[model samples]
Target: MPSSPALLRLDPTACGLPRRSLLLAPLGALAGGCTPGAPALQGGWVGTHPERGHRLRGELPRTDGPLKKAGVLIVGAGIAGLACARELARRGIDDIALLDLEDEAGGNSRAHALGGSLCPLGAHYLPLPGPEAHEVNELLHALGLAREQFGRTVWDERHLCHSPQERLFIDGPEGGYWHEGVLPPPDGAVALAQYRHFSALVAQAQRELGFAMPTQRARWTAGHAALDAQTFAAWLGAQALTDPQLRWYLDYCCRDDFGAGADTVSAWAGLHYFASRHGFHAPGDEAGEREPVLTWPEGNGWLSQRLAAPLRERIHTGRVVMRVTEGRTGVELMAWNEAAGAPERWQARAVVMATPLFIAHRLLASPPDALRAAAGHLRYAPWLTANLLLREPLLTRPGAPPAWDNVRYGATALGYVDARHQTLDPMPRPPLLTAYRALPTAARGELLSGSWQHWAQSVIGDLAATHPDLPGKVERIDLCRFGHAMSMPVPGLRGSAALAALNAARGRVVFAHADLAGYSVFEEAYTAGVAAAARLSL
Candidate 1:
């Protein structure tokens, strides 16, 4: 078993990131190369468009605008906000309004379309809803993704992710290449045994403690809750699970879901990744094959779009909610309309703050000490996603064909997801590959201060290792940098009193967002929204 410090310093290159460049070069020079007149990287940058959100840090110019009246005002149009609005409408509450700072309302679930291909900016897939997830099941049924057949929910076949679902490339026996799934190659018998042991442990945890979506539903006994007291790496050490391959796979799962490594993530949160889906079985499938996932070319952006469709007229894009004050009869909100170039005001009987917790702290007026302390304890992990439009398919050596998800072992980035993998029609043109990387909390400063060109170069260079001709096959590369991509479920964070305080409603304002769940995921965000709406309805 490795010491805590040893686990903490797993490996500098474990994330598959390139070494820091010695020379600091300008954006133009770095992107197009040292040679002048070379064409710049074909794509531009897109994100949540942080300008208006940043403006919340300082006071805005006072405006004499009349306050608009609303029965409910939801301050955000992300998944949580949209879910709140949708739930309100479902309950026959129509006098509600939703606002978002981004031009589009999906938040990180936003999608981009280029040359007839659609790709995701952030979240891309959702696991099959558990039996206890009633709201989620209902939402899926409403969206035509699911239906009741003989008292069992049946998911749409077309929407399910097709196989050859995932593959991994590692330096090992078969010319340093292994195919099928993200697990370690079969050559590592000891690692495989450890993985099996770990799986049994997760199953036991699920049976005993109950790890499932909407985290609020999980049975948090003193024994299970104790898991949050230690780091995942520490737990691994205690179990004597010292296989390097096993550790790497576990670390990858942490980075992929929580945007942090095992050493920084909580044992409970890490185990939740496995236990949460313990009994998740797709509709009409009893063979116990891999659980099916609902996905589209645009990823969860498809679900986001559907959630926003009914509330389109009620959603106000580019409206930044700067402040929220609880009044005797209702809640008052001051916002700045980027499109109108002026201040806007709203008064609502109830308000749901579906924004991130960090933003909620800034917007709330005279927040309670508990809320403030809870917000302070919350940490966010940054992520970078680049969509590369290729003029041709990636050149492959003899092995499995291009899978929907391609992972490179020992690389900083989590390889790339092929955006065209779900296309029904025959692709007559090149494909669009969406590459993803979750920057460790330590690298957040570097990502923020670095130029887009530098990040772009890092992405291309990383992929070049897997596909040698990747550079020349690329035509456009659009980069999406999420400074606070997902909430990091560090040790002592999940199931903590701080998180409970953060989730509690304050006066007329109800909090909603994935962060409240202590681990960011589609189900948590949606559930948070629904929970907030239920509170507002009451």
Candidate 2:
């Protein structure tokens, strides 16, 4: 077994800059690489390859009695499995099969439509990758969106989102948007500036090569990976970054990415959140528009539907895999076929466990030591997304520009995004905006088992605090709570030896999950899917 890059620490000074850092000031900017295009509304890239629906080897043989066989059997039809399928199919392998407990292909990125508007069940946005992401660019062009500017003002095509994106509802008044224009209190102003400074510093480090190591083991950097082996709390204290400004930034970042705040996450994992985004745009430099995200009337399910188009007939829904055993001859999967109420078996050359870590911990037989270690290290947080249908558009303080995402300062969780934002023209009725709650790990058991009415009332009450008239304007309230909506990069989890082990594939079983990547973002999912495919192909 090779030493994982997670454990490496080379000389940072040799790369230039300061002694503690690697590479001096980027050697005069290196031409700023390729410019990324504006973010599009499309999924960015979907089925662009020549072998969009190509399969590997042959379809799994249908059996009258019980068992079936294939070259590679992938579990979970999420992005990871689909990416693997696409890669393998392109390589002239057509005998692969994929299965998932859910009927769709995208795991968390799935969406559903309500009242003619599509709302997200899990993920919605995919940020622009760095300029060096050639493969992503290729995929985008192939998807027919290479030149399209998403979210651009159709009339002018020169501006984007009209500037101010997000505004905060604070102390009975709007505290302005996240950047300029919105007015914040003195402390808020100070905190926001400091936060920006810190973000800029982190971005600088990320732009450099030493800290941006992509390989499995640590690269030519001096900083110890073990330094990240502590909770964000410990790391912050050690670095003396406990000022209110720094704290607020960390708290907001944690909430946005992991659905938890700083104290709940690992410092290393938190750093990974900022360091990993390397999105790119073309025909221009950093001044170009962001890569637009593709969305369905049902949110990301639009992309899922496209990816699953070719494999729709081959999919077997409700097949809950109970366990997997790797025998001398082949791998056998023991599953409870939910549709027929019978236990079924499957044999294949390779298997992809695309399910969440929590599920994988119990389903695979004699799991590799790394997987066991990861199972023990990984922790997931539950979520509650409350969708409220309003009879009237709740009025806010005048001059407070209405945007998609609305947040409340010092709230229980981040606020909600108007699911109807994508629809430009006016509508006869007010649509639903989903209020998402990142319930603390300590509150999971109670929240999950609570009554629906109880949860709905609580959510309404919370929203009412900000929009006093919102409750009365609401016509219908629909509640959807996911017990394990996301994975938390718990403090000390990132640099742990166990994590490195779990990330490593054992024999024919390849592991892929948002949790394994440290950051739970859409791009990470895409990268994970692509990485899993490359590994399997090798």
Candidate 3:
């Protein structure tokens, strides 16, 4: 396990986790290294050891140890990697090993601690799985989060996101006020009219052009292709739905899930956000309801930890894949062991490149056209999650009380999630707010170059409006940055022929990652891993 910041040494009471949970809660955080970009700050980076990942672009470290052998070697150890291993095991293929660059598994869906509280460092929340996501549905059932009762799906109420699920702080003449939901209030008659039109459009989309969560589940037609060929913003413009508030809300939704707003992502992605999960709803509509999500203080890290627990002995961390070579006999992988400070080699009959498509492209000795093209067309979004420990609750505004998901209107940042919102205890001690910001591709440089203090201050300032005294209440702030957080489903990327080819590829090395899906989501990544494992000849 990586050493977390010493700021959380106050006591366990500050954390909402119970005593038994304190013992049983699986926590694996990435270690931080001093960088040229570093200076003295109260908080530091906690995710994606940037140094280790960036090392791939530089020179080599020669191998020193004897070659390690395995029946199968799976790289990544993320949600996809872990799922691959689990599926392979279920098939009675036990002779396998998993490796990751970071000291811990869970890639983007990892956990960290702040002021004794377990908080999400990256991706959080798992929405209710749709019918076509059989793999995910099974996993939820196995984990006791959901079950089929009398031919109807039933969830464990405890795991479902508590009511008052989300809210948006809308700017007004009176500063800003909290709205019950992330959607804008549709302030004017024109906006309201546009809202109803959009709602009907969503219904039309569901009826005429079907949408599904896993995407693979839905049938791809000319209608889907047309939507994929243009940007969401372009599509919106063509519809004559030029309402500012509606556009802002649409942009916010795009940024939240796909990492880019309407101008960047394809039209299919924007519509899929609402149409696939639940149709767009205006206030007073009979179907107006929020989608239930499963969350904990540590977010999806809760699920990741459980997925990783069963295979602890077989998992290896801090092993950066140097090169991958496939031969007539088997596959050869050279990995650099970070902790041991030595190079190691692995000989495996089968290898799964369960990493981002770009990373896999860099690793392979001879890459296929499909893999190369897929990697070439892809663009990853830079993500930043800052977990701030609050000494006390923030001052609440009118409307709904505090919510699990809090967003600020017209803000570039996605806003923050209250880590303690789901706590069963009525007593208050301290709470951690996990603030998320998905930056544009251009800002990747600044994200990597900026000091932890600079970014921490920026995050605090961004949220300061919602809580005027936030600066005073915060005890510590720990920020995590991912350079290639997720693949943005830009126009034409989803229906690209190259992705189809890569998904169909079979041999000694099988590719698996969210990148293969042209977008990042738990369902896509998890299913991709399982599919990859199934393709294994073993």
Candidate 4:
């Protein structure tokens, strides 16, 4: 793991995890470079990461009293803040306080229980960590999750992802690993070849372990950053890898990773999807395939809950911090105490603002002009995920057997993950699978204002393209929209000075967000949080 700053080192009370526990959290942004003429919309003219506001069930309570005098004040209850708080608590430094605008601590990791299944409100899955990704390993181990219990990583048949891992519904039939025996004829062969070729290229990039020049803050291998200079479309064009079928696959990959199409994501970011991964088990553990990613029905919210366990009592929710100014006394956090229904202040020697960059912009109280300029250039893509409860298993399209992540080859974003996939109960009435659809910003205007019925109808309509009776089978539809889900990793966004400037802390006031990490992945959030904490510890 990269060296985190000092602020993250403060220790909390004995009731929580060790400071070391803070070091590992689940395990787990953009720049604008344009020529003088107001650059043309290079790729798809779409906002990549947008937000879907959280629906507060009731009015929040406000607080006026000082929770506690602390050496550190961490803002936001999302994974980043929780992880930081957990780490600080473990450190034996009890003088700490955490605040968030939401009444809950998970932030985007929030979930809802519906029809016997849990649905994720924000992030869903975490990629297994690489060898260098020590932070994740530490976190998992700290959480009491032993690699041995996971069965040596090859995903033993018992622990292995069950029979139907994935499937694609084409025309009228199904084709995927679940239906490996039912491979589609020659046409299927063509698509497979395309996938093979692209996979090979990504694999080659991995072998090379490419690193960006100067090597300071590349998201993945340096090699991946070099690829950032080109758009995925341009990269594909160079491969002469253009076929309508292949295009759909590429689009699916981009939609899954960037919440947009291949044409929109930077080629480097797309390659990182495959290349940055180095999945291998122990020496003797038939590690043919990488470790099977472990997830709960509500996706990453499960992990967030696990991490929050140790800090439940310390977290202050619905407290929107509006400003952070350092003084001779320490750091002053000017914030709104939701519970008390009034503006309140907090004092700490150091503070970490773990909220999103856009939110931080307001809290920082007049950031450097460059940071402000970059914040303006950065764009977030909004996403809407629908977790539908089905009355019964919908008819499989002849050859396709539904698996965990059922993705439509050329349809809306990547399809849904079967919530019951992880459940042991093999009864006929299994839990319903939730479909997560990411609507493009252009479509956001239409989707956001629409009712749940409208969104549910849209989801069923799209699935109907392949599964004719899908709409009738759905018993309930739960909707959660992440308005600013993630930042788009565009070409110029990779190395923009503006993003770098936002990360710069002008004395006492520090910035923290998964966005500042420049990549919206679990590790990025955890690492960024720790980094902010480390800086304060100094």
Against the true structure, whose lDDT is highest?
3
- lDDT of each residue in 434-531, candidate 3, tens digit only: 99999988999999999886677677666664665565566678999999999999998989999988788787889889888899999999999999
Q: Taking the tens digit of each residue's C-alpha lDDT, what string does model 1 give over 358-394?
A: 8888888877675687688788999999998887676
Worst 10 residues of 4 by lDDT: 25-34
lDDT of 4: 0.59
Put down candidate 4 lDDT per residue, 208-269, tens digits, no spaces.
Answer: 76532112244453555567777889998998777566566667766776777777778876
Candidate 3 segments exceeding 4 Å error = 1-41
**After aligning candidate 1 to the native by TM-score, how far in Å is the CA of 389 from where it should be?**
0.4
Global local distance difference test of model 1: 0.78
Task: Give one clash count per candidate, in the order shown.
Answer: 6, 49, 0, 49
TM-score of 2: 0.75
Query: Model 4 — TM-score against the truth?
Result: 0.77
Candidate 2 versus truth, CA RMSD in Å, comes to 15.8
Which segments of model 1 are wrong by more than 4 Å?
Answer: 1-39, 172-175, 279-289, 502-507
As for lDDT, the candidate ahead, 3 or 4, is 3
Best by TM-score: 3
